[model samples]
Target chain A: MKYTIFPGCLISYRFPEYEKSAKLILQKLEVEFIPVDSFSCCGSQVLESIDDEKMVLLNARNLAIAQELDIGSIITLCGSCTHILKKSLIKLHDNKILKRINKKLRLIGLKFFPKKKIEIIHIAEFLNKKEIFQKFQNLVVKKLEINIAVQNPCMVLRPSSISNLELKDRKIIRNLLTSTGITASSYRYMNRCCGGTMLAFDDSIAKDLGKLRYKELQKSGANILAVGCPNCQLMYSIYQNMLVDDVVPSIFFTQLLGLSIGFSQKDMEIDKNINTEIISNILNNSIKNNG
Target chain B: MNECKECGACTNACPLNEYDENYIVYKIFFGPEKDFKLWTRCCSCFLCEENCPYGLNPREEIFKIRRNSDRSNIPPRIIKYYENIKRTGFVFNIDEYVNEERIEYGLVKLNLDRIKSEVNKLFNI
Candidate 1:
């Protein structure tokens, strides 16, 4: 039951609240984790094209550190981090790649032992585990009745192989949000790409794709958009004000979960969010069911 | 059409195709197309990779093309981001102010000094 938080580059750099909310929930669940800040980037998309081998080597170092620290599970807040780390973990299984990686890893005083078996899981997937889910559901001191439209992480649950989510488990993010006793409804673009990856190359297309989806989200009538990925947060949360007229105020599902678990507004860092004012209004109305 | 099946699933499933009609995903996979600029448009969501009935990875091919393509053809910002990661492990620059902000928010402050040489050996930065 030991875990370590893989606070990815994007979450660590820009969105501290996402990490804070997740840590608070894990703490409340009594799950212990080592705070490992020694690890570097997951080699995100930037390194993948520059040198795919470097990407693998870098992530191998991360996996080696996880194994060194005796971490059983590495909970990631960003989908890309989960995907890259998992992808490298699978690739490092090849004896040849492992040997080459070990050569470099030795310089850094570390080595990859595949037998240790570190599980690289996104927070959404971790929260959706049956035992964890039941524990999380039991902590629900108040059930907010707001209808939430969820946007799933593309990297966290795709390709069916690298992500390791089965067809039935495809709704991990949606299912995790549903536990809050909030109204969970599917929308036309619930599983579509948010073009967050394109921000590296062509940002206009990313914003254009976001505007297209936000327009539909405005029409989805869900009142709030629950997203599990930081890239989606950048689209539907950070850029919501500039993208649409009537913003839906995209929020991390954990932030909403923290409140359902009896945490107050300050606990969730409600003021840090761009659409905090609107969210406060929604929270004001949502708590009427608690009493 | 040789192997793409032109099933239109990839294009239809693509978020970018909705805005730009010329952004046909299968055609890029079908290839003989020369515009690396068009290849830069993908968000790398893997939707097309998942959507393709034949399981061919257009996203991977596009990146292969991007890797082999002339450096001048690629966008400047992406190159800068790649360079930054090579120099510093993280994409965005980390400074005292950034770490101070994290601690103020009740999160752990990052110390890159520990992993600097490790990532340097990996990236040879």
Candidate 2:
């Protein structure tokens, strides 16, 4: 369970709670984390779309940092980071690309040898690893009774061919919810894009997509939405106010697990959430019921 | 080897395409070679490729265009993000709020000076 952690731009800046909750849960589970410094952005879709080589270089530099640490496997909290890093890793496997990148790396005193490849594991896949979920499931003192819906971001689930992900991540999220005694709500738009990519280009369109998912979750009786990607959480969480109807609070999957592992509301930074009162109410009600 | 029938099914399935069908349609009709200012609109969601009936990944075509396009015409925010990475070795450079938050999380404050030096040596920035 030992690996290097890559907390991409958003988690490090706008949403450090994901890092905090993740670090706490991973520490409790005895999973060793080696933090790599001097890491850059994931070269998100926008960066990649403008100049593919720059994106590749940025991602490769991050991978090289892990390789320098002698860490065989790397885990990321952001789905976009996981997708971009995994894509870069696969691309670097080509001898020509490796040679080209290594030439640039040599200038920085770094080298990416194709012979020694590193395994890129997303946090979802890391937790889904054989019986690990079961171990966490057994530790839940209070199973959440609120209706929880899961948003399977495109990077985490669909376009499976390029993602290079093998785990049934969406099912794992569902199972994680169900095992923790939380009701897993499934809706038609569960697999739909949250319009995150379009948020920067056309916010109206992004909000439209977010509103669609929000309505579906409401129709399914879900009060809280759990997501694994920071971008997805960012979209739905912010869209709550933009929507006129009842809007469910969106939380990171790690934060959902944090509650079961005994992390308090403050520890998970639930207050910083836009719709913090929703989750706080759920926790308060759970306490009242247990009392 | 010729599987694609140019049915535009990929465009029909794309989430971003729903925002503006003409953008994707324009790309498909006239590959990524032309300087389509709206090229940055593609979110890299890969939905269109997944729904493609011909198994042709239009994303690759877009990527080819992006790779060859001039870097100067991209959005200002994206340019700033790249500059931040080159100068600070971070996409969002450490600020007072970020420093305070890092301390709260029990994480070490990043040595911006050291990181910048290392990045300069690496990226020649």
Candidate 3:
């Protein structure tokens, strides 16, 4: 019912629509949450690769803040943030590392007491656990009948260990969409990286890799691409114009659910997305047909 | 015998390998030598690490080599992210633009001063 919302750094700054849509939908669902506004970055895969120690310490500080807020769980929409924060929380089990980090935090009057019962969950996990789909079904005024191809971000679903891949958030998302009369499908490279991590290092490779996956997603004949990770949305939506024709534009999975639950396109900030026209048309046609 | 098994599993499973197999093979052999533009093609998917029969972490191996070998070769954007975090205590500094967006969406402007001081003390930056 209540959790601390960690917007991470990138989503809060670069893509505030994710925060806006999530806030609006969660408000409608009556999920009580206070934003972790001062939280630092999650030490993304790039930082982890460069300096594992700093990555652990940085994320430990964020978790300490959650403990400060006295919340048992924190919900994050960015897959990379979820992965990094969850993985770092798991690393705190080592008493030696905990002591080291606590020593550092003590300098700032912040201390991370290991085993504080803090849970870092992806938004998909949070919604699935809270049965948000049933709430959406209860509140739906208009059902948007659209076929969506879902991109399961690697950080969110793969390597199966640190991430709650066993929970199969993909299935939860599909079920959630279906509850609102929308159908979802998977295309090739659904599990492949969307080049989100590599985008900073190699833009060309990142675009090509996303293009490879988008081309396959195009074949799925789904008009809209639904994704669990903000990075996946960033990859597909940012590169929409350069990608193949009829390339399904990406939106956060929650945005689509918000649409079904009676929020208009403006409420979800669909127009701010790079492929606005395509998504706008899809929404318009759905409204026309249902009306 | 190369501490790598030469199993070619990484080459087979990598997404970038689909773009150029010979280039990846060569990068694996000579590494940090030859043209590294091809080396920059790795997308960090870790699929190769997952599929490697020998349990060798080729992804880390390649990234380690790249990190140690070049200064200028490091991506400017990644360096920018580091600088921003070091100076502002977050990956992104709270600029007027971001502050405006936050206010527009009914979210409060983030006060990074506390986190910034904490980061300064912790990292000695």
Query: What does the lDDT read for residue A277 in candidate 1?
Result: 94
* Chain A TM-scores in order: 0.96, 0.94, 0.93
Superior by TM-score: candidate 1 or candidate 2: 1
Q: List the residue pairs that clash in candidate 2.
A: none
* Candidate 1 CAPRI grade: medium
Full-model lDDT, candidate 1 = 0.82
Model 3 DockQ class: acceptable
Per-residue lDDT tens digits for candidate 2, residues A201-238, read 55667786677666677788777888877788778887
Q: Per-prediction DockQ, in order?
A: 0.74, 0.46, 0.46
Tens digits of per-residue lDDT, candidate 1, A214-241, equal 8888778888898888888988887768
Model 2 spans > 4 angstroms off: A165-169, A243-245, B19-35, B70-73
Model 1, residue B96: displacement in angstroms?
2.0
Descending-DockQ candidate ranking = 1, 3, 2
Worst 10 residues of 1 chain A by lDDT: A172-181
Candidate 1 residue spans exceeding 4 A from truth: none
